[model samples]
Target chain A: MAKRLMPLLNRVLVEKIVPPAKTHAGILLPETSNKLDSGKVLAVGPGLRDKTGNHIPVAVKEGDTVLLPEYGGTTVKLGEKEYHLYRDEDIMGTLHD
Target chain B: MAKRLMPLLNRVLVEKIVPPAKTHAGILLPETSNKLDSGKVLAVGPGLRDKTGNHIPVAVKEGDTVLLPEYGGTTVKLGEKEYHLYRDEDIMGTLHD
Candidate 1:
């Protein structure tokens, strides 16, 4: 049996998306962006419980592309790939296309 | 009227306590501690709104001493004093005596 990761309490697991090195016009891309990083949501945790004990759903679901902050997140290594864990609120926004 | 800070959404306003340079026995003290900083709670936020807009009360109240993490907090300047703002959950613990 293969091990699986299940995030808890509104945490989201994401795999970063590496942008292409050059544009179609042959313009080189910067190594890093100080503002945001692109990633795909791998897993979503059950929503956090409010004071009243009601579950609050997370903002994004599995397979959603999201904008991530340049810094701050827990790094998790599963097998050979690297993943990041962030609070639902830390995910900036979802990509449309 | 003087300016007042009303923290919102489970934020806390605290004034850092500067420990004495030397112990009662005359041992010199270090400039900073990596573990925690002592602070007095000046104010507490109304509490973060859950998905359903329910209120969740903060853990500590004004005048209580608390343990603050070594880093990560918003600093605010009010009048001639400096204060720090932290999420209610970020506060480590309440200090006794």
Candidate 2:
């Protein structure tokens, strides 16, 4: 599914695709698993507001594999797909190989 | 317990104090409830490295009540208490009244 754009500062819109069914430990996991994984960055906001009221640039770009936190995102459904809209600060780190 | 400092970029050292017992829904939750809460900011890193290779300033200061992500922090025990050391990006927001 094509991703929609989010218009706001510090917000990111993500298409919640189901993660792979197994872990690196080779254990079978389900959708309800609390494990977090990396996802393709669909869309990002301009950035957070700096202390001086200027916009601080975002470190991440679209299409990066990012690690997200387990909670606090607002979940929404777009057509038949579930997506999350959260602040960029909620993103933990970029997954490196 | 006194908090120990973590030396690194983007890392925040927090004392993992147990959350308040009840939820807004009036349910009594335990420490394993998986509910995130606000904590007194003990120590924070200088900040993350920006795209330009410069140190970006941290938005949070010591003593701010911040919302932390549920997972991804490296747990450490200093003395008799368990604490977490994580990146500042894992912090969701500052808790305001």
Candidate 3:
């Protein structure tokens, strides 16, 4: 978001939503990288071609919270932070408030 | 083409098109597995859900020749043959007759 790094052709750009620190049941919580499944959508591709060669728009839009797969993505760096490029389909699901 | 391995929700099943052996310039060609990019589509997902909750329909259909990525796929075994499961977006392109 601070930098421009757009994904192409059914691909989506996302940054993993690292968990916040907390304490629960007298235990320090979120010490581990859990919920790697969650990420913030950054940029998206212009959609891939369809049978008739028309674009079949990507499902998620920028600023949307999305579910990410544990594996599979092309890591990229911008400024100082890292982002990932995942095919829109590889994104497992979308999160809503 | 011999198994029932329907890929789920934007997934596509494919078997790499291994090049046939041949001789060229007194050298045996296709011995090193070049053009692994080509594949035969076996089965495809019924498409993934969209923002509206309707299926967005997979781009490629069964029996289409497709281009495969160098990596990133779940290997599957059926009988004596091995197949691959790729998200439809991971498929780079489709080959036509």
Fnat scores for every prediction: 0.02, 0.00, 0.02
Once superposed on the true structure, which residue ranges of model 2 sit more than 4 Å away at CA?
Answer: A1-3, A22-34, B1-9, B12-85, B88-97
Q: Each prediction's Cα lDDT score?
A: 0.76, 0.64, 0.72
Mind giving the per-residue lDDT tens digits that candidate 3 earns over B1-97? 1234434468787898876566555566746556456889887777866554456899998889998888887665543466677888888888777
User: What would the per-residue lDDT of candidate 2 be over residues B18-50, giving only the tens digit for each residue?
Assistant: 676888898887767657755667677657655
Better of 1 and 2 by TM-score: 1
Give residue B4's lDDT in candidate 2 (0 to 100). 40
Clashing residue pairs in candidate 1 are none
Q: For residues A10-95, write the lDDT of model 1, one tens digit per residue.
A: 89999998766776789776554223566789999987877667777786889987756556889998887889999977664454
DockQ of each: 0.03, 0.05, 0.03
lDDT tens digits by residue: candidate 2, A16-85: 5466577678878655543444456778888775555655666567776665566778876767777777
Docking class of 2: incorrect
In candidate 3 the C-alpha lDDT for residue A38 amounts to: 68
The positional error of residue A9 in candidate 1, measured at the CA in angstroms, is: 1.0
Q: What proportion of true contacts does candidate 1 retain?
A: 0.02
**What shift in Å separates residue B61 of candidate 3 from its native position after superposition?**
24
